[model samples]
Target: MATPVLPRSVQRLIDEFARLPGIGPKSASRLTFYLLRATDNQALDLSVALQELKERTRLCSVCFNITEDDPCPICEDEARDAHLVCVVEEPLDVLAIERSRAYGGRYHVLHGAISPVEGIGPEDLRVTELVQRVAQGQFTEIILATNPTLEGESTALYLQRRLAEYGVRMTRLARGLPVGGDLEYTDEITLGRALEGRQEV
Candidate 1:
């Protein structure tokens, strides 16, 4: 059945919302209607926030993470371990690592992983910039913190080969079972990695 006649402005908003990833037509319609019924300040706040998000954020010139400044605070901080760099797939991955507070090093955001199926490759990412940074900087180690997936592995391997000539030590994030997960429910790969990475207790 056709959708009931909606005003052009309302339909436009619904269409825009539907264009966003994971937002279906029904969800888009609901969101548009919700904003329509919301207070003027609320809707205006959302619009302004979106506008500022685009206008104020840019990829950091050093690490390629989203930031309002060129080098970003992490790259600028004197307290951070400048000799260590954690390389990840996206800006969100940087955020995830930061929340853990277990690492006090810098970061390099690739924006994406190698995925031939998606037509994304080394050139499509920030690999060249990373290589240049390594060559010019005094980093002692590059931590491959990419996701534990096929594409992530491929990207890490490619990076390892490219940075091999620099002789900088490279390390991968250890994979294992989660603390709350049971061994019986764990996949074979996770179990194997956990065993391989086991520490003396």
Candidate 2:
């Protein structure tokens, strides 16, 4: 049977939703139909929220994290350790670290990792800004909090080389098994890292 033709507006919304990362055509169609069936102002609210997200949010000048303010709250907070900076792959990573509540220092969002396969490189990121920050001689250490993926590793290595001359202490986030994970189920990389980073009990 031929697929029934959808209205242009409905199809357009579905197509837009489908363009979002991790959203398949079927999921987009479901979302569009769900919005159509809704009696409340959810669709309008979503539209307004999206508009505000684009219009109101901007990158923090210092850290490159998404924020309504220029420096972002973390960068502006004087109580935080100004000399310690944790460099991460994206704005979401900053949020993840914040949720941990273990890090009391500020952050620097790289926007993305160095993925040559995806055509992303240091030039495409805020590397220049980070280098400039390092050259300013304010930070005493830089924690490389990039993920353990190949791209993340490459980005971290490149950053290390670039900032080595600045003489600021550079450290990587320790990789290991999870708190409750089984040793048998753990991957070799994580297990090895755990062994390498083992601390005296």
TM per model?
A: 0.95, 0.96
Q: Find the 10 residues in a row with the least total lDDT in model 2.
A: 38-47
Q: How many clashing pairs does model 2 include?
A: 0
Q: Which stretches of candidate 2 lie over 4 Å from their true place?
A: 1-4
Cα shift from native, residue 187, model 2 (Å): 1.1
Steric clash pairs (candidate 1): none
Against the true structure, whose lDDT is highest?
1
**lDDT of candidate 1 over 1-201, digit per residue (tens):** 986799999999999999999999999999999999999999999999999999999999999999999889999999999999999999999999999999999999999999999999999999999999899858999999999999999999999999999999999999998988998999999999999999998
On TM-score, the leading prediction is 2
Per-residue CA lDDT of candidate 2, range 153-196, in tens?
99999999999999999999989989989999999989999999
In candidate 2, how many Å is residue 128 off?
0.6
Q: CA lDDT of each candidate? A: 0.96, 0.94
